[model samples]
Target: MAHEDASFTDISIQAASSHQVWDPFVRLFHWAIAGLFVANAFFTSPKHDLHHWIGYTIAALVGARILWGLIGTRHARFSDFLPSVSGALNQLRDMATGRRHAHIGHSPLGALMIYNLLVTLLVIAGSGWLMTTDAYWGVKWPKDLHEIAVNWAELSVAAHIVAVIVESLRLRVNLARAMITGKKDIRRDSR
Candidate 1:
């Protein structure tokens, strides 16, 4: 009974130390984009007005997010997570050596993935818009470009999920929960 109580107390202390990393706008943007993407990708008909509206919403959200990235909270800024060759190489070396560094924001490689997705989505939006324009109507290349971009974005999303799970296990961090609750349970020792 005493051991159980001690363990419970320890957990409480640990939880208390967890830091709020994701702000509300960032969290909302993450889940909203995910839901919108899934709806357009799986559930919605391409010819439906609803589908086009959803795509428009996604484009707007991404645009707003880009603006936020410039002037948002610490973890939400482009400056915080911009990818760098040297930084990515160092992160890769850490992975190879089994060294876990708990990042409060996106890591170097993760930053690259984020940028990739953002640009991909923007391309998807642009190509989609072009399809609606009279000049580009029935054009093969824009449609082809849009489809290719969608496929790439889907692949990137899958890879992102896998990487998140792998990193969470490796770092012993609840990253998904952080995105949900806007907090991360990073231990002092881990940092």
Candidate 2:
């Protein structure tokens, strides 16, 4: 009995030390979307052809990501980290209580942020496209919507960055590194 207990603990420790979570497709999609958003937001002017092309590209990438979410690797799938109110509350409780529980994939709040950003980006793309059409040319709502959504997305991105840093410190996991490398190195002592 004692030997069995010790062996089980050893295996648990080893498994918790490190593991692959994000697959290559997920990592690529994440960085691509990030870079494209930065370009469209800062470098490309709306009147330029490059801006329109980047918007189209962002829309296509979002489409691909939706499909991938439906049929992708375990951690990449939507089912792996569905957003939940209870889960978020529980995480908050854990934080308040100083309880350490590191998620191998997206945390509940993280999942919510992911969904929020995806939808916001889609709105920005759709509105931008509408403004280009003959029927909606010179229309104000779509253009207004596009601007509003972009502002929301920018705020969301800032919040996401802060949350990632805070969670990484709390969990003692290098989350930004994990996204880049497709692996998370969780300490064995973490729960």
Candidate 3:
């Protein structure tokens, strides 16, 4: 009974130290892009007004996110999460040794994933836009490129989901909840 009480107390303490990491705009951007991506990729009919508009919106969101990364809150800034080879290597070492270095912002590998997805989104959007242009309309290569980019983006999103789940479990943090709530309940020991 005493041990359980102590455990609960520790958890409460850990929860109490939680802080807001992802700002409101950051969260909105994250989810909006996610939902919009799904709609355009699967639900929306191709070449229709709705699909075209959604694609444009996604491109706009990506542009907005890039701007935000330049001027947004601490965690949302690219400087906070931009991938570093040394940092990634260190993170890899930590993983191998089972060291829990819970990052307040994006982890090194997470940063790389973000970069990957952003570039992929741009490629997808660019190719899609080209498909509608007068010069490129009915062109086979642009369409092929667009399809390839979509497949790559989908696979990347899947990997992102898997990584989030795995890291959340490994680090004993609710990463998904953190994205939703904008707060990270970082364990004290990880600090």
Candidate 4:
């Protein structure tokens, strides 16, 4: 009973020390994109108006995110998390060496993943939209590109989920919860 009480207190202290990371718009944008992606992929019929609207909404969200990346909060800006090959390699090295370095913002590999998903989604949306236009109507390449991009996005989402879970375990940080609550409980000793 005493041990349980001590552990609970420790957890409370850790939670209290959590730093604000994700802003409201970032969180909303993430979940909105995720939900809309799922709805369009699995629920909505391709020929339906709902599907087209969702695609447009996703494209709009991505555009807004790009603008936000230019002029948003500290962690939301593109300058804060530009994808770097060397940085990603270092992160991979850290993983291989079992060195846990928790990043306050998105890690290098995470930044790369973010860029990949953003571009892939944009491609998917663009190709999808082109399919609806008279100029690109009955175009095989756009349809092919849309299908390919969707598959890539799905794979990327799966990888992102796996990476998040692995990273949370490795760093002892609830990253998913951070996205939800806009705070990350990073340990003081970690960099």
Q: Which candidate has the highest lDDT of all?
A: 4
lDDT of 4 by residue, 1-191 (tens): 11121111112112225778899999999999999999999999999999999999999999999999999998899887877777777678778977766677788889899899999999999999999999999989999999999999999999999999998988788999999999988764443
C-alpha RMSD between model 1 and the true structure: 8.4
lDDT of 1 by residue, 115-148 (tens): 9999999999889889988999999999999999
Cα-based TM-score, every candidate:
0.88, 0.90, 0.88, 0.89
Q: Report the CA-based lDDT of candidate 2 relative to the real structure.
A: 0.83
The deviation in Å at residue 189 for candidate 3 is 4.2
Prediction 1 global C-alpha lDDT:
0.81
Over 1-191, each residue of candidate 2 has an lDDT whose tens digit, in order, gives 11121111112222357879899999999999999999999998998999999999999999999999999988888887776777777677767877667777787778889899999999999999999999999999999999999999999999999988998888777999999999888885545
Root-mean-square deviation per candidate: 8.4, 5.8, 7.5, 8.1
* Residue pairs of candidate 3 with colliding backbone atoms: none
Candidate 4: the clashing residue pairs are none
lDDT of 4: 0.85
Per-residue accuracy of model 3 over 133-184 as CA lDDT, tens digit each: 9999999998999999999999999999998998898787899999999998
Superposition TM-score, candidate 2 onto the true structure: 0.90
> Which lDDT value does model 1 have at 26?
93
Return model 4's CA RMSD, one decimal.
Answer: 8.1
